[model samples]
Target: MDLPQLGTNLLNRVPPRLLSAAERYLKSVPLLRNRLEKETDSMLAGLEGDLKPYRGQLPTFATLPTQGLSHEQVLGEMSQMKEKEEHRWKDGLVSGAVYHGDSEHIDFLNRVYALNSQSNPLHADLWPSATKFEAEVVAMTAHMLGATEANAGRPPEQHICGALSSGGTESIMLAMKTYRDWARETKGITRPEMVAPSTAHTAFDKAAHYFGIKMVRVPVGPDYRADVKATRKALNRNTIVIIGSAPSFPHGTIDPIEELSELARKRRIGFHTDACLGGFVLPWARKLGYPVPEFDFRLPGVTSMSADTHKFGYAAKGTSVVLYRGTALRSHQYFTATEWPGGIYFSPTFSGSRPGALIAAAWASLVSTGEEGYLDATRRILETADAIKRGIRAIPGLHVLGEPLFVIAFGSDIVDIYKVMERMSARGWSLNGLHKPAAVHICVTQRHTQPGVAERFLEDLRAAVEHVRANPGEKGTMAPVYGMAGTVPFRGILSDLLKKYMDLLYKV
Candidate 1:
């Protein structure tokens, strides 16, 4: 066995605390640190070309130009780059980056953005329209996610309410922070913790790290959904909330939200349904006769939810909605600084000065798309996803990970899935690579609903799988990297590698 693999195996046998100490000590050693730096630098060097493709092609700016470039010149350069990069997503060759890529929708949103370019929701006095747009966006999203049903016989203050966020990550982080504050104040829980399935999004982990909350992740069930028994066992007095996904990112399987939320309700703890992926689709999916479980505010135990307007909502890229069961819980998410010299500052979300243009775009997308538009879009996307799932299952060695509606994950017992992903990449397809079972997923979007896109994807995927099976000995550029990432026991090493990659992104 290779030396690194052997070392990883040895480390895996060590106790958790001791292993962490050993990892720290190993990094403290100058020689070991230097060797790691050299290897990381070399690996990053290989990726620099693809990441910085315009290095030699376009003008590089270490600092600003002596004088500002003409608007025409700037637009020309941007247009060139846009044309070069648009094809992959335009043709549905990518996974989830661009959701609704229709020209008319894009143009409409662009116009809305341009019109509200100077509006800032932070300065509501100056731009009441921005606030109107944001409030309506939140209300519209909340109603769609069962706020109306949840509001039945309840006071307005107890009705479902929400705030506009930049995206899903912010919405999730906002809810987590809100829960942390709420638990600390109401439950008197000094040390906060959250219980979630292993399939919950990494944003929860980020929130835990940032907010000083302990994250307890339980194992998923055989069907790739959250294990209720395991989740119940993981909860404790310190658990501020329980998290369930409407449809998880990796496996595209919805956790048993009903049972999970009930557990939280019985405990009197918060239950957050992260519907960021399925929020816009599942509600419509259920209306279209799909088996979507109760995951919204309609569930009594569901105290909060996050829905991205950017993903399936057909909004422009930057807006999402985070809802609370009542105004009281949402109050914990607010930030008000009366002590500041800036004259009683207050902000709803993380950012103080927010892009009201994106809010306007989100509002515009929702109002324009309406219910029928979302239903039609959801129908096409789910139908396309069904076809894709069938095709993946038909591929001899591959199997769909779960019974998914739109987002589809697949794996193979007979082939190196990572190698198959690499082959797909070579054929100009961009797909998400998932680990902890090692699979790949395609988040079916409206782009994939276009004519022949599903068929094209299946054809390319079949060819890629056959190629991987026929040439088992062939080395792949990213396949080995993905393989190592999935199997390596030393998570700290991989984390460091990712940090270095993030550094590389800022290197220009």
Candidate 2:
């Protein structure tokens, strides 16, 4: 217990021998467990201030008030908070939070939401419009992702079809569950595992934990694409599915889905390309003649995909698409019950009752922002992303990672990137911190493509990098946290700290 121990099970498809033994030895000690808990609590205390910005402001409520507050009061307080938050994201100072922030688009989606506020897809028998909207949204998404070409000779049951989930995480989790069930029933694989690139979304990890699916994380190649050879070697008889990202969240580099999927094809296993961040952007980027790699239904091996309608689809937040190559595969994602007290019920997604208003807004966004709309948006976004990339690379200390179309991560050799990130935050720019090799990223969206937005970003970034370079010994905000996150080999301590952070998130 003197040293940190690793978690058991497959880390990068299999655990390190020393880690596995260490994990067991340390886990047996009572004092180590207690000390770990105390350390995690202390680490979480450091993050509490940032997590709870309104801790001392406003009238906080851990539970609903005995009587509801006046609507005007609620509105006033919410408006104030929104105003505080809006400036950062609205002015294009943050990364990946807001996609399309044009007031016209925002107003339009808001109107759509208000119109269908009471609608619920669970009672689709009553709200058929919701059903219609969701169906069309799926169909529209499929067509854009090459489903038409892939399903040319296939039956409707074998055509690309999907359901709407709350977000990217839900879409991903549902897909993993579907794969687990599909593999078990069809392929006689009792034990299920999913193989994914190291750069793949963490939602896959969540899925693995949630549905008892073993996740095999394989390393990415030098190009930051999935190592197809390594993936093949990692796959076992129980591996139900393989995954590659259409420009994964971290590196923003598209995995070689064509090659990866073909490997999955040869093995007769499902291949899922998670385009959560890139799905809505990539097709348009490709059409715009950007150097986009093949990472879609065009590949015969891509059996499933997840695309965030909320991210690049310009929909309100709470919507995402999870598509299967065929209804047969998607059917496994559905949950059905019969002979219950609540008589003969079925839910297409995880939630029994779903907010149809978001789906309505999603539908509206897709239709209103037609092919032309997407083309224009992608054009601006790509241009801005290109500019940002150029600026980052031009910086003396920084270097860009991989050939990325939109979401960009840059690392520094001369300054602590995390400290630079902290400096950016003080200047009202929020960004993401990355590790393994320390770096930071900004996932560019339409918001970032606004006039002067990219230029302003580079200006702030240069100043921030300079500030960090000037202040050598200064332990800037979040730098210590990031450093601890990266250097702390005790994953149990990190995971426990993360849990406490989550607990703070739920604090009223």
- Best-fitting candidate, measured by TM-score? 1
- Candidate 2 overall lDDT versus native: 0.89
Each model's backbone clash number: 0, 0
Model 2: clashing residue pairs? none
Model 2 earns a TM-score of 0.94
TM-score, one value per model: 0.97, 0.94
Q: Which runs of model 1 end up more than 4 angstroms from their true locations?
A: 1-13
Model 1 weakest 10-residue run by lDDT? 481-490
Show where candidate 2 strays beyond 4 Å: 1-42
- What is the C-alpha lDDT profile of model 2 across 128-233, one tens digit per residue? 9999999999999999999999999888889999999999999999999999999989999987999998899999999999999988999987778889889989
lDDT against the true structure, per candidate, is: 0.92, 0.89
- The Cα error of candidate 1 at residue 475, in Å, is 2.4
Report residue 165 deviation for candidate 1 (angstroms).
0.5
Top candidate (lDDT):
1
